[model samples]
Target: MCRCIRLQALIGLLFLIFMVPEFKAKAQVETIASQRQLFVDDFLVDQLERAELEMHRPVDEGIAFNLDKLWEGKFSLYTTIIKDGGTYRAYYRGLPDVKEGNDRELTCYAESKDGINWYKPNLGIHEINGSKDNNVILVDNQLTHNFSPFLDTNPNAKKSERYKALAGKKVTGLYALTSADGIHWVKMQEEPVLKEGNLDSQNVSFWSSSENKYLVYFRTVDSGFRSVSRASSTDFNSWDQGVEMKYGPTPLEHLYTQQTSPYFRAPQVYLAIGGRFMPNKQVVSDEQAAIMGIDPNYYKACSDAFLMSSRGGNNYNRYFMESFIRPGIGLNNWVSRTNYPALNIVQTGDTEMSIYVNHDYAQTTAHLRRYSMRLDGFASLSAGYAGGEMLTKPFVFDGSALELNYSTSAAGEIFIELLDEKGNKIPGFSKEECQPIIGNELERTVYWNKNTDVSKLIGKPVRMKIYLKDADIYSFRFY
Candidate 1:
């Protein structure tokens, strides 16, 4: 009787150990309560039946502004644009000639009411060529080499530190600067904040609302290739030891500048329109280079803008390896260090947003060009004329209705069906009950049985099965 009792106890202990993890795993459904989910990656997708995630290229809209100022010459680079309230502010490094030191480098500024037409404002803060009438804002030799700034959106950020910037090189490390307004600036500390890598490119930083920490992505040489590393800070001064960003199974390439910034529409998803450089990929011959008056050392290699994104931390998703903004039809554009994307994507119109790119590098026509994309149109879940379906992973959300940023042909339409955690069709929310969604709109509320109320299903683990034909779903959210 004692042996039999011990055997029963052993069986019960093994059962508990094996069954507990399985139960917990099932309960670990994602709790994406009210966050906007984008189709930039497969993060929220479980399966696709004859549907695919497609990349959408931005349309080239022409020049926003030329590098025509005296201080802003052929080498003006590291451009950053901030849509502060109604005014759009622009900042970039102004280098007339590539010399040995950084003494000649000047941080210049520009502004526009609309993002299309930009003009340099004469701040008269820093003197260049014995004149303070230029748009030169900061003139420090070390800091202006690659000065990058962003409008601080932190709730607890002091008014005096409303605008923040990070600037430095390998020798000086990275220094932090702040300004009450977007123009005037001062150093946050006398010492560099964090310095663990080759800090030679445009080091971009922003206050991440999702992570609740200030994050910075800067240049680092990884395995003989130009790469990016990420670090975080609660305050602007102290930073955690950074981690090198991983690009999952992709071939290592020289990413000259990782212009990583939080998507304004979806702040949790960071979009990096990076410059991918290929050394020795020369296009312009020496004769062609001389005719264009290109810098002697800059025409030997070539670079173009590529799209990448990250939710948070050190992993970047490179869904589309092709160039986001191709160096279009010109020898000057095919030269070294051309086609690098500027730091931000800003809304320009009701349904349009614009991305700025530095074009014609090392040439007389160096300028920032504007490219427009439909709002939230970076990537999409698309289906052809033959209808297809997409099933989302299980998640709990809190909202009364579902809104979608989508576009469809006149004959194309989209339908949605709600599913329980076990993939069972929920009554009254099946595809047959859904109203056909058609038209090109930024935000269209989805309805089922002529009803848009989804509050009753809030906090319940559910999935979305989207059926479409000749339509593209850019993004969807519960709101």
Candidate 2:
């Protein structure tokens, strides 16, 4: 009887050990550095203790350029600006009298010294309006609809190809063009590098340092609405067929242009501010269009820019459905395809960044306008006066101190606590030991108990818990 009781007890113990609930060990974290992470959403979030998402809007500074020049009018689109060394270069399509084919469209160029004021430099490279006094770069070619260029940053790039461009219409496919000085462009290859997958969109490419190759973000259609796709190349001539991007459980919508490019501060997190097109969502009436001196056909569809992001692969995270940019209170901007954003966001001021948008399309006073926002201030993780907390996912970073781009009210405060991989609060870096952070800064080092260095925990898998009270954190990085 004693042996039977002992055997029954052993069986029960084994059963409980094998089948009962058990705590699992924590998963190891990735060792990649989190230098510049955007506040798109809970992409790296592990938990939230009453915090919420906040969206930031840009302030329209003024009209960047008037498209009243030769061969340029309200039909211009796809504006790309680059801060090359000290000089700024702006490129766009110029179509004064829209007809058809390459004869009607021309590639226009502009230059800005400080990005606040712009000038149309007469390169005298291409003839337009029966004269070379215009700012035309390339004419009588297939780059008119979408001639997107990037200042090639590849360390191994040739001097002749310092500026690379991709231009093509839908029927002809995408052609590779290279420039020695961005004024005079020539075909790098004789044939189309990519085709058959909706090449009608602005096919923009860049030499990615992360992948050590050329990356392209073009357009496609998802269930009849415009969507995005991506491709890659080694020598800018040969490219693999792109894979359509997936927006992770978010229902599809009409996204006309997906301006997916590497963020200036954080290249790893690609910023995609695209035009969310509403085909017939007209806010402007026919009489109102005429009264405002707007084109009738231009008031059909309306669009507003939305925020999206990607790490590298063919995927986008549209965290906030709210509009990043809205067509403000004006009849000119309410017209269709007027509020389309430019290709890139350029740093114009010490604490400000500017994004250009095409406004008043198809009107006599059509022009490109500038919108400004704080550096790295697209969206923020915010909290009210009542206070809230947020915990980040486990990550391994190589830095001694933490910095933040944040803003707060005079009475608001922020606190930080570094936690172990298992989410347990570390001994010396607990919230109780943290000092109240107060100020609006682009880069402010966070301190705990008067200690700014965390080099001892640099390579270890750890997480951070941020506490906020009427504060907004735009970005966080360890360096």
Candidate 3:
């Protein structure tokens, strides 16, 4: 009897150690439903069998337009682009000469029908030099320094406040501005919204549909490094105290501008393509700088654009530490604050999106350039010629068919298989039965045994195993 009791106790201990944890994990399975999942990070990854996540840089498409206007010159910066219906609107600070001080800074405007070709419309809103026949929108010296605006998407937002902006310096804190047509602007209140940070760089704000609040990411000093802080508000006028953004274990670097905005496709995920400034990282010598007509003080330091993402809150995922948009092969490209990306990423074509960058800063050739990438192509789950596989964490999805945004070489192919919560292969969805996908398409529907319907698996927790051979999977979704 004593021996039997001891054996029973051992059995109970083993069950608690293994079974309990497995049950807990299954209980916490993610309900992904039909949301698109990008390979920007390992959020959905459970195991990798020789597969790796690779970052893809955008392809340089040359200069979109030059800041050659009389009012717009080399010092023009802080660009923000918005795609409202068929019209693409652009805003930036136009300063011909920095020596003229803050009084010379003015907010300029430009518009585009397809986001590629741009034209500056003479708004006659603010007078500059001797005439009002310029594209100057606002002339406030304090706010025009870094006037960033976005088309408000909040359903509750009033029509008069359809467009909103935040602009100010450390001395004035940050002020809120609203516009009905995104051209004329008015102060939302007499006092600043939140006066807790340095508020010097491009302070980006947008309405977060997932969090149901207005979110703002502004510049703040953290342990002597230029960092970012976040605050939220139900109403744009009032805001929280804000918290310093935490980057897990990554070395601190000077982030000059945190251009945080929700990805148009995946509004829950916020993408930040900001300028990473390296003070005193000089590459251009005195003689080299002079030949390129570069600014003396600006040549000492250099900046490049980096990519980071956040689901919501004050935490950012810096999965790729490398530059998103590197400087081109020229002395003018290697200058301070040159490769800074604009505020937003706009879709230029059905399968193409564009990111704008300020190139050749502090020089006579300074202008905004365009870079293009395939839709959801920021990063990809890649496999080499040797072939590899990846298993995803168990998730309950609500869909009937699986679709993927992927690309492959002529000899490359991708196969997907569904598994039960216990890692067992689900019948009819086995890798052996999958009709190998082999093409470079933006949205290709996955099929198993020539069958696309998976309605029977809806609401049931399952895992996905992907096999690849010289192929890249940018993103996947069920529909």
Structural similarity to truth (TM-score) of each candidate: 0.94, 0.93, 0.95
For model 3, the stretches where C-alpha displacement exceeds 4 angstroms are: 1-27, 99-101
Give me the displacement of residue 266 in model 2, in angstroms: 0.5
- Cα deviation of 449 in candidate 3 (Å)? 2.4
Candidate that scores best on TM-score: 3
> In model 1, where do residues sit more than 4 Å from their true spots?
1-28, 99-101
lDDT: worst 10-residue window of model 1: 19-28
Return the lDDT, model 1, position 127: 73
Ranking by lDDT: 1, 3, 2
Give the winner by lDDT: 1
- Measured with C-alpha atoms, the lDDT of residue 337 in candidate 3 is 83
How well does candidate 2 match the true structure, expressed as C-alpha RMSD?
A: 3.4
Q: CA RMSD for every model?
A: 3.4, 3.4, 2.5
Give per-residue CA lDDT, model 3, range 353-434, as digits (tens): 9999999888888789999999999999999999999999889998899999998899999999999987899999999999
